[model samples]
Target: MITDTHTHLYSAEFDEDRAAMIQRAKDAGVSRFFIPAIDSTYTNRMLTLEKENPNDVFLMMGLHPTSVKENYLEELAHVKEWIDKKSFCAIGEIGIDLYWDSTFIKQQQEAFRTQIKWAKEKKIPIVIHCRDAFNEVFEVLESEKENTLRGIFHCFTGTLAQAKQAISYNMKLGIGGVATFKNGKIDKFLNEIDLTHIVLETDAPYLAPKPFRGKRNESAYITNVIDKLVDIYQVSYQEIAAITTQNSKDVFGI
Candidate 1:
């Protein structure tokens, strides 16, 4: 059974056919999905999604970096309230995103660090949402390094060295649609990294894999990602699925 380590299955993009979309994924062997939080706004939908598909849907709590706006404090509070009351798979989609505005860089850093602390305290993993701010994110992670600081570096788009550095911190590289793009460089050096440190993701409603590139992504599209890895690692599709899904189990403990 294939597992999508990261996917926004609760996104409004699937509103018209959420059930169909999920069924399509399951029919395609994409049976497990881990959902990340954006903010308090998506909390109810995330909860309802899990409620409807408890066996297949697992959730994570955190304030996404891009959502670190003026009311970020309130957003963090919302995250904490649910965190204290629920047993999420991870604390994630957290980290710094400089690809957009840097106006709230400090706030993003603070939020990232705080959430990381909460994750450590709960003895859970964190899913990082780094974009154009690897150095900054690494610095914070460096300061907070500990035996229990483990997670996925979501949508990892970085160099071989960066991959090694992230792995050094006990993070598995979250491979996604970018690995299928001709210009997506991760595929070039992915074989060098052991399969044990990689996990598959769709990051759906965005970053759709090749052939579906530039279009809306869904969990069903994860097979395209698995196909690319079959070529990159020169392994059978079943091996890729088994290894990556096992890697995800290692990270999420689910």
Candidate 2:
């Protein structure tokens, strides 16, 4: 079974066809969908998604770095409150994001560290969303390193050295549509990294794969990712699916 280790299934983009979209993923052999949080605004939508797909969906609670702003503390409180009150698979999609604005870099760093501490305390994993801030993200992970500080580096598109560094910190490389891009350098050396350290994701409604690239993404297109991995690792599609799904379970614990 394919496990989309990271997917924003509740994004407004799926509002009109969420159920059908999920069905398509199942039809495509995707059995698990791990949902990440953007901020408190999307919390209810996320829970509603889980309610509708209880057997196949898992939830994560955290304040997204991009969502870090003037009232970031309040947002972080929302994340911590939900985390304390319910069972979540992980504490993410959290981490440094300098891709857009760096005005709140300090706040982003604080939020990343705080959430990492919470995830460590709960013994659950973290799903990072590092964007143009690998060094900053790595700095936090490095300082917060511990036996329980483990997770998936969501949407990983880093150098081989960065990939190995993330693995050293107990993170699985979350491979997605980027791997299918014509210039997605990761695919060139992905075979060098063992499949055991890879996990598949679509980041749906965002980074769709080739043939469907530049279009709206969905879990149904996860097979495109699997197909890419099959070529990258020179393994069968079934082998790539099983191995990456297993890698996801290793991080999410479900």
Deviation (Å) of 9 in candidate 2? 0.9
Candidate 1 lDDT, 1-254, residue by residue in tens: 99999999999999999999999999999989999999999999999999999999999999999999999999999999999998999999999999979999999999999999999999999999999999999999999999888999999999999999999999999999999998999999999999999999999989999999999999999999999999999999999999999999999899
- Local distance difference test, candidate 2: 0.93
| Residues 1-254, model 2: lDDT tens digits | 99998899999898899899999999999999999999999999999999988899999999999999999999999998898999999999999999899999999999999999999889999999999999999999889998777899999999999999999999999999999999999998899999999999999989999989999999999999988888888889999988888888888889
TM-score of each: 0.99, 0.99
Clash totals for all candidate models: 0, 0
What residue pairs are clashing in model 1?
none
Q: Alpha carbon lDDT of residue 1, candidate 2?
A: 93
Show model 1 residue runs off by greater than 4 Å: none
